[model samples]
Target: MSMFRHLLGVVITLLFVLLTCAVILPILMLALLKVGLPFARWQALCNRWLDWLASLWMDANARHQQLLLPTQLEIEGLDNLSKQEWYMMVANHQSWVDILLLLRIFNGRIPYLKFFLKQSLIWVPLLGLAWWALEFPFMRRHTKEQIARDPSLQGKDIEQTRKACEKFRYNPVTIINFLEGTRFTTAKYVQQKSIYRHLLMPKAGGLAFTLAAMNGQLHRLLDVTIHYPEGIPTYWDYACGRVKTIQVHIRQVPIPAELIGDYTEDAEFRAGFQLWVNQLWQRKDDLIESMKSTGAN
Candidate 1:
């Protein structure tokens, strides 16, 4: 029965994607043309259209999840959120279903989440072009070892990343960062000898760089923590209605004056920011423990 359920989910999801693409592709072509021209207003107009399309796409997915999954989701701290404000959303990564869960949680409460996708993903057929049309930032992050091999390449790539974010200034945007950089696994936990039992060591550079880029424009940081009381659920498990409980806690942290600084050049600021993020991770680990203990989730 579960296998059949998963198969049904797969078919439904594919049909949803195909239907969305069929309508969006033509609009995307026109938006792409407007973006290519030199008119700023036309570009903004196109982005608004893209946002509307993205919102509709997310709403459809959310409705499907609600209808198919018999899961109890407890969400908190999004009461005062406005769709007109710019937000930096940070979360921990656990499963492929995480993104879907997030979309369902924040569907109409905030602007559609825009991710900084890997440059390599730009070749992923329909999805790649969809991301581009939505103006999702495509980034190529350089490792420390790679930068060490070529000293001059140090800050250049980060500058490019900052430049990519420039387009978001025209409208309210919710930029999400998975600080752990990858899904948490037992093997990864053992390899890193991670201090937090629940999470990996966050790569603070990308978040710091994003903060630097948006600077004064960003209103607040949405610190979101997701926990699965029954265990980490796969997409198939979610689709089969096996994911019994999902606990999501969102806290709005005002962006402090100190957090906005040149993280690449200012050593003191970088150290301070990294410490802050590590402390936040520790708190989240404690929250996850508490959530697992209680039946509230």
Candidate 2:
């Protein structure tokens, strides 16, 4: 039964992707060009279309696969969110399905979510063009070793990318960063011997840079915690209908006033910010444990 279910899920997901690439995507791309909207507007329009299509696909897939979303999923403190406000969303990475879950949950309540991606992905055929069209921030990350070998490369790339983000000033945006940097695996967990349960160590550099660039313009921080009841559910599970329930806890937090400055420049503020992030990860660790315990029953 599981094998058959998996096969069916893959077929459906592929069909959806093919249809999206062949039909919906080209029309949207042409529409953006015809309207003469800026890249940010074009991206926003594309994301809205993707979000709607995903929801429709999920509903149809769920009904066919006999899957169910959480009936008692609780979103606390959502009332604190303002439609006019800009936010920075940070979440622990788990699976590719996490993106779809976020889109479904935060749909109309918050500004459309965007992520900083690698510049290389910009040429990735269909999805690449789509991401570029959507105005996703594509960055070139240089390692310390590379920078040390070539002393002149210090802050050039980051500064160039930061300048590109200036265009976002005209549009309300919610920037999301998966602080863990990569999805969790037992091998990686063993390699890092991570302090937090079910989480990798939070990478502070990206968050630091993001906060520095956005500064006072971002009104709040959305700390979201997600858990899958039956291990880490894959995209196949979602499509095949094997994933019946998912629990997500959203805590809308105020961006600490002191963190509004350039975190890279101030030592004291940087230490304080790192400590706060550690505390958030610790709490998320505990939350994951509690969810696992509840799901066991």
Candidate 3:
């Protein structure tokens, strides 16, 4: 049975690659067309096309997963979502599976989910250009030492990332940031001496910087919490159709006026924002514990 599952995992992986390969060319083509056209209307048209292709890609994968796996999703708070509005989603990260789960669950329900990529990723040959064409915001991060050495470097990365964000102002988009920054692990949880029993420390600076950079254009916040009831599963376990259940909770909060400010320039705003984020994280940690205990989820 183990060998059979492993074989199925390989087959499932191959199918995923094939599906991606099928769409990549069209994606690349539209991306090039978008770049060549300087007109705003034309670029908007291209973006719409790209989003359609991505949504279709996601739907296709979902169909196959349902056919191949018995994974059951228990979800709450998705009814109010729409694709027409701009949103910022903050989620707790666990494994690579989180990305797939997010894309699958929210496909077509919101504007295509966008991720902030490392600035250096733009150099990758084809995928990078495609991501750029799709307008995935690339973030340039400078370490404290580097910033200390060059006082001028402070806030430069955010300025660049904000300019990249400016294009989304023309159309609605959902930007997702995993506050934990990295996937959660028991080791990491212990290392950080995490205040929450089930989560690593959630970083407020990224969300603050993103909000400030967007200049409050993001209209709502989608607070998403994902929990694996059977324990953290590997991608292979999910692909092999071994994982049984997933739970998701999304609480949509309005982007309050107070939450938008220069997180870099204003010390007071920074402190308030950090407190707000920490409180939010604490709630999520408590909720995850409830989910674990209640089993009704």
Per-candidate TM equals 0.94, 0.82, 0.94
Q: Regarding TM-score, does 2 or 3 come out ahead? A: 3
Check candidate 3 and list the clashing pairs.
none
Any idea what lDDT model 2 has? 0.73
Against the reference, the lDDT scores of all candidates come to 0.84, 0.73, 0.88
- CA deviation > 4 Å runs, candidate 2: 22-80
The residue-level lDDT of candidate 1 at 274 comes to 96
Per-residue lDDT for 1-297 in model 3, tens only? 899898889988887888888888999889888888878889889889998888898899888887887899999998988889999999999998999899999998998889988888899765586677678888878899999999999888778767877877777889899999889999999999999988999888888878877887898999999999999999999998889999999999999989988788899999999999999999999999999998754
Flag clash pairs in model 2.
43-134
Name the weakest run of 10 consecutive residues (lDDT summed) in model 1.
11-20
In model 3, which regions exceed 4 Å deviation?
120-129
Q: Give one digit per residue, the lDDT tens place, for model 2 in 1-297.
A: 878777777776776576546654654555467357557667566555654554454445444333333223444445666556788899888898788777666756777677788778888766676566566788888888999999888886658557656746666778899988789888888899899879999987777777777756776899999888777877777777667677888888888767755666788888988888999899989988998997788
Each candidate: RMSD to true structure?
A: 1.8, 3.9, 1.9
Candidate number with greatest lDDT:
3
